[model samples]
Target: MVTPGSPRGIDVKIGIVDYEAGNLKSVETALRYLHADYFISSDPSVLKKGDKIIFPGVGEARSAMRILSERGLDQFIKDFFKSGKPLLGICLGCQIVLKSSEENSTYCLGLVPGVSREFSVEMGLKIPHMGWNQVSIKGSHYIFRDIPDNGSFYFVHSFYPELDKSSQVIGSTEYGIEFSSAFSVDNLVALQFHPEKSGPFGLKILDNFIKGAD
Candidate 1:
């Protein structure tokens, strides 16, 4: 398995999206530790130059979208998707890419045909669902390369995206009901968990993502 260093596959101009989203520091630290070159940019033009974009967000859905809109990052992301460049969205980043979110009845980027909803407290499930959980890998996705099918990762969120059977659910974890833990379709992928905070296994996931960016 390849370690988190120079991709050894492709040299990616990595750009991390800065939309006032929390957990950016952890993500940036991981990349730095991985020896990957990256920059945190709020400017669309600077981001457009990136070969791969990382949208690791952790904030309220409505306000996050509003920030994206106000900064004109909404269209920038859309155009980036259309450009077929690789994008990795995490946590709130994952939610904002979906069709809609129950959090404040917010409409999202609609890249993934799914909805982000809160885990019901009535189901005896804890709100936020914070903690480490095992994720069952669906297929032989590049993102899962060097990572076990049932690896544990750190998660800290109340809501998750509900994907259809045919949805690009590369990794799944059962909280109360089965929910998508990670989604990968073509060049775009999103994760509900925080790989940066997930230790060595998380590093492997990020390494795989970088290698697969080509």
Candidate 2:
């Protein structure tokens, strides 16, 4: 949880993983607006040094996995999570945190059980759940401290993670079916939506994360 304190001297070194498949610039700009001390790196060493890490993606799951494997980041991410430092995965980045993905049958970081699968065409809903959507909080989480219930956030994805109910699911949203939109277990935090583009509510969420890093 975040405690009230001076925003300056926070000294929080946040690392945003550049796996070569995401909108990292927008995320970095949002953090900069919040005065967060951060850097963008694909190197495992720099990532390991971060007090917190943000994994953001905006492309295919298989391609993203290929990039991570090609750069040997798969193992680095796993080891980093084991270190108990806070990690926030966004968009397809959140899907890779799971055990595997059905998109290409590729193994993932396995930080969480279950696999990511594409939304069923039979559901008759849009393939990609794009545009703004409201995410209902399922439970109290440090990330949503100052955010309101049923807050709208921007999202763009065709696939969604089917996490086990036993896992800590902190937020949910409905497209064709009710599915997890965000979740956190210990230091691993993930969001299927793009909070960086979600306006003031999104900024508050980032602020809470930075404050908690202290």
Clashing pairs in 2: none
lDDT by residue (tens digit), candidate 1, 1-214: 3354554577777899998888999999998888887899999999999989999999899999999999999999988988998999999998888999999999999887889989999999878899999999987888787788788999999889987545588888999998999998678899999999998989878887766733
* Model 2 poorest ten-residue lDDT run: 1-10
Residue lDDT tens for model 2, 1-214: 2223336445789999998865798889889888788998999877888898889899987788889888878888888888988888988888889988888777888899877888999989887889999999977888898788998999998888889754588899999998888988789888999988888887778777876733
Scored against the true structure, residue 134 in model 2 reaches a CA lDDT of 91
Could you tell me the lDDT of residue 108 within candidate 1? 96
Error of 2 at 139 (Å): 1.6
* Candidate number achieving the greatest TM-score relative to the actual structure: 1
Model 1 lDDT on a 0 to 1 scale: 0.87
